[model samples]
Target: MRPDLTEPLKLLAVRVERVLEQVLPTPELEPSRLHAAMRYSVLGGGKRLRPLLCYAGAAAVGGRTEQADRAAAALEVIHAYSLIHDDLPAMDDDDLRRGKPTCHIAFDEATAILAGDALQALAFELIANDPGHSTERSRLAAIRTLALACGSQGMAGGQAFDLGAVGRQLTEFELKRMHAHKTGALIRAAVLMGAELTGQADSHQLAQLARFGSLVGLAFQIRDDILDIEGDTEIIGKRQGADIARNKPTFPSIMGLDAAKAAAEDTRQQALSALSSFGPEAELLRDLAHYAVDRPS
Candidate 1:
């Protein structure tokens, strides 16, 4: 049987939620509407998978959860920002997220746009100003990592591809490449940023972690595609069949459902293989690889 990570994951999620709350601006502050929109988009929902990956990455490198908290929160903030923009009328035009109104729906489009922009800024600020980083060099490196993941060659670029892919037939390779940036980039960043903050991983270990992250990222996206088809709207916290509704190409749509499921499992196994050099400390990450593919929503 798999190791039970229910308690540990919950605790780490709680830890990161506290950090997010601390860093996000208060609704009572000036610019209250923007702050409220930001908080609404980020707080009180979702699986917190990216933050969990950040914490798990730190633990894999013998770093403490406290050291990873800010980075975890930063990843989650960036994720929230992406979701906010993705749900805008110009984008996916979704009405529900986390089983409630999306940011653009709950607030005006302008406020939602500003909320996403502000949250993006806040993610970088959190990393740049984090006291948990051992050195300026490490902090800068972490910042750079996240920046690249969010930039044209990463998440944004992938989104461009995704938008362009509507009503088009794409090969499995093309689909995977698009997701590697759109979905996988940030996921990879969370794991790498966590390990980088620890300042303990050697170059070899970092490389291994990167490999592990890449595979996990792919598996995560594949599973997300599967969930979009099979998941309940309430359970997945988004409208069911949104991808299909948008005519967005997905793993299941491209490769068939069984093939996509197998692909997710295969990538999960590859991710685990990348951790072979690690000891029991990486058990959490290994479990996460399984979770990436096996989670119901």
Candidate 2:
């Protein structure tokens, strides 16, 4: 039977929240509105899956959760920034996020954009100046990992593919490629960053972890696509059928719902397979792979 992750996940999430609170600018600071919007965009909502993956990755390499905190915080900040931009009027024009008004909806468009930009800059700053890093090289590696994930070849590139693919029929391979960058890149970074921070995982172990992260990332997107079709807006924290409404390409749209579900499971199995070399140390990572598909939202 799978170990119950309810308590562990909750604890890790709280840890992330505390770290974010410490690192993010207080709403009372000068440029108060921008600071408030940044805090609002980051603080109170959404599943902190990326950060959890970072912790799990560290654990898989026999590192402690405390050691992974900076990387975890940085990943979530980047994620929050991405969500803010993705919800803008020029993008998805989303009104809801984490069941609250999106940044652009809660604040003016310019403020929302600035909030995202500031958060993006802050993410790198956190990673670059992480005092926990034993060596400058390790810190730089973490920074490079995050930068590549957020840059033209990673999440941003994937979003570009998504925007361009709207209302167009794409092959399964093409769809997977798009999501691989958009959703998978950051997730991969989270896991890799966790392992990298420890300075423990050798290249071979890192390779296996990367494989695990990639498969789990694909599973995550497939489950999200399925949820977009079957989940209630209140439960999923976003508009149900939003993808269909936008005619966005999705696994379900290309392969059918049942097929998409099966694909998610298969991808989850592949993720587990990638961890075959690991022992009990990787149980948390395995549980995360399951959670990626089994989560209700």
What lDDT does each candidate get?
0.89, 0.91
**Global fold similarity of model 1 (TM-score):** 0.97
**Residue 95 in candidate 1 has what lDDT?**
86
Taking the tens digit of each residue's C-alpha lDDT, what string does model 1 give over 101-164? Answer: 9998899999999999999999999888877455677778889999999999998898898888
- The TM-score values for the models, in the order shown, are 0.97, 0.97
Among the numbered candidates, top lDDT falls to 2
Tens-digit lDDT string for candidate 2 (1-297): 342356777799899999999999997889999999999999978789999999999999998787789889999999999999999988999999999999988999999999999999999898788775446877788899999999999999999998999899999999999999999999999999998888888999999998999999999999999999999999999999999999999999999999999999899999999999999999888889988888888
Clash counts per candidate, in order, are: 0, 0
Q: Model 2 — which ten-residue stretch has the worst lDDT?
A: 1-10
